[model samples]
Target: MSDNLAIRKIIHIDMDAFYASVEQRDNPELKGKPVAVGGSRSRGVVAAASYEARKFGIRSAMPSVTAFRKCPDIIFVKPRFEVYKEVSQIIRNIFFEYTDLVEPLSLDEAYLDVTNNKIGLPSATLIAEEIRKKIFDSTALTCSAGISINKFLAKTASDINKPNGMKLIKPEEAMAFIETLKVKDFFGVGKVTAEKMKRMGIHTGLDLKNKSLGFMTKNFGKSGSFYYNISRGIDDRPVNPNRIRKSVSIENTYDNDLSDISHIETELEKLSESLETRLAKNKIQGKTINIKIKYADFEQVTRSKTSQYWLSKSTDYQPLWKEILLDERLVQKPIRLLGLGLSNLNTEEKENQGLQLTLEF
Candidate 1:
């Protein structure tokens, strides 16, 4: 490890079932129930599941019907995004009180670099505890926190003790902790990758660490170096406050696949309108209009067209959507999902957003 690693402090704070927790906090009747915040329709998906709901295997992004099947009495609540955003801002304000180097992963989670905090705190663990207490006092919401030398380790540590708990991985203990860590628990290693690693006898961080750099590179390409480094507890990524938004998109999966061209086109138009509203709300414009189609057989394809001028209105992309949908291959199969997105955004330009790292004792 480098000398800089020993001097840095990072914290990952994740709200406990944020959406459902908010609903439960607002309604007394939902306090201890298996509450899922989302639509209850057959095509609906769970945006978040309370801890009670999680016991029944309910999880975010799960199909509502499947969640219902898992737990017949699960209460489904509609999401109040405005309320969530308001609360998120309040939490972010609390984070800013400690450090401006806060990187929000979502409305429910963020990373904080507090090696040099506003109040001149010496321990990252205490700061995490104070933040969690303030969050509970303000929002009646519990959050879990992880403290470590780097973002990846801190993120992993946060999950160790969940639902209003905190865990710290000291600089010296990082390697030992990671050595025994499950491969699946490593950040960025998905189910498919975990299965592949298991097949290759890489079930733990130590197993991954045992592989030669050249061998890992040969198998996993560029990502092999990332895996190798992180296995040994080396993550140099800074806590970026001004993380850029890569794209703006809207997508929907229908309960029933649409075979008719007219129906598909109508849905596409609706998506385009929704995308326009979102883009207008965010004040984002892009030169590339992209469409994604997923067939009933699970095959997916994406098509994109780059325009000379920036596009933000529905009318601007409706023609491109029609042109993209005109393909015979798309019409041959019934589509289960339709998505529209804009990329190469106006905010993609480079800027001086570097962090001002300091070590204040």
Candidate 2:
């Protein structure tokens, strides 16, 4: 590839039927039938399922009883987390051999940045194919690979082909490819955002690309800019090894010392735009919203809010922001550096015991 623009060579690797495949590798009879790895009927959820299980609409996280309803002949295998972890390590080690920029989303999937790799391979496609072969050779497992210029595109491309397959998205063809993609298919555009975009007639990349960036920004907050860029296949993001946000924050160092109330608002607007992008990309719901201010004299103070719901997206900030911005103490400060960070991770346990009670899924 030409080095004119320094595009990132990203590849997303996903193992096929991860847990189920491992079970089938050792069990001869389970090779061709629909298989689920999890608890048996009457309790527990399906952690993984073979392709045959997918055919019967038996999916991971479904109740064991539900899976039975989907496919009466479905076979349920207990989860062996230790074995899966060992296999995951093997694959991860192989990835490090090609590139240190490997970001694992889960045991079964990872994103690798091979722009500057250890082996100096000429093509990312070759790297992906070689990796696939190595995985199968080592574990007797089939995996899917996606090669593209950015993480988002690569992740999407990985799902296009399954069961030991590969799909490459070149820079030259990116725009045309994105034009046909559904809005929901875009990485990071979840159900809520997709529905919101749909209401605004943003059904596909082509439709999203046709809308003004300003409009998207107004409606979706900071993520709107990223969505606009991605729809046009103009993503400039790198293949980061650590994609998870430890904290989501937006800060600005103003050109001049700001004392006026309007000045603070203007800087806040810019920061809000940037902050929203980071939060949406990671899909992390934050509990605390922290505000930091540094005065001209170098004094800094931070204020935080603990929210009940995980801040799912930038839109979730609306309620929190109204409270924060209206606070008299924070608004009175002559801010030089203004920042916002979301942290305090809190997760909710599943109310429904997915598989513990039913032999479903």
Candidate 3:
């Protein structure tokens, strides 16, 4: 870990229960109540849960019925995506006031490189505080922030004191902080990966740091190198403001499994139409068409075919679906879910010219 590598000042800002918060903010009657932003229908899923709802173990992507079971008084509200998007843009404009080096992870969270800010601020902590305040003043919403030398640390730190709070990890303290952090708490380590690491006796950042690079790469494949670097407070990746969309996909989970081939084909046609609309919305074209099938028993598999010419319309890729569905493996069992996606996009190889800036503290 060289001193020069820790020169950048990064901040991660994440809104507190974004969707639910917006719903509560707009409708005061919903305030301080257990609120889940989603449908309450039989196949409904929760998109977001307010802090009040979270006390009952309500969470996003949870079944609405399960949420109701947890808290009988829970209120389910439909999502207003257009309103959320408008608020997101307002917050993005605030970030541009300080620096153009802003990378949005989603509508509610973003990574900002304020090392060399427009206002020439020397303290990243101050910048984060100011940003949080401005977001609240504009949206009547609160947010949490993390300030550190790089994106990884900043992202991890943001969750430490969440819901309208901020934390800073200075360059010198980065390694010590990470070493004591749980392996499950690491930014990219999901549930399955955490379980795998636990089985391997890698339960914490220190345990991860103790493993040889060869041992890690052997076990985790490509991501092993990333884990190795971050364990020692090393992440050189830049804050890419112009992040490209790698793929466009649409998936549907049915209330009941479909065993009939005709019914499956009809569902595939609907998915193809949705995928095409999304591609056209984003102006995306790709060479690879993919299908994902999830069986009633939870077994899932994907099939893909690549063509020399780009495909963007539903008709262009629907023919490929029939070719893929001919596989014997697909009809062996009833399918509970079907997905269609396009990848190897026209924009895949294109790179945005980014500005390089530095700060002296």
Q: Identify the leading candidate in terms of TM-score.
A: 1
TM-score of each: 0.91, 0.66, 0.90
Residue by residue across 190-286, what tens digits does model 2's lDDT show?
9999999899888999999898999889998999988988887766555556555457686655545678877776677677667778776766667
Instruction: Give the range where candidate 2 is weakest over 10 consecutive residues by summed lDDT.
Output: 352-361
Q: Judged by lDDT against the true structure, how good is candidate 2?
A: 0.79
Give residue 65's lDDT in candidate 3 (0 to 100).
Answer: 70
Off by over 4 Å in 2: 1-5, 242-361
Residue 72's lDDT in candidate 1: 91
All predictions: root-mean-square deviation over Cα?
A: 2.6, 17.5, 2.7
Off by over 4 Å in 3: 4-6, 252-260, 293-301, 327-337, 349-361
lDDT of 1 by residue, 25-119 (tens): 99999999999998584656788999999999999978788899999999999889999999999999999999999999999999999988899
Quick one: ranking by TM-score, best first? 1, 3, 2
C-alpha lDDT score of every prediction, in listed order: 0.88, 0.79, 0.89
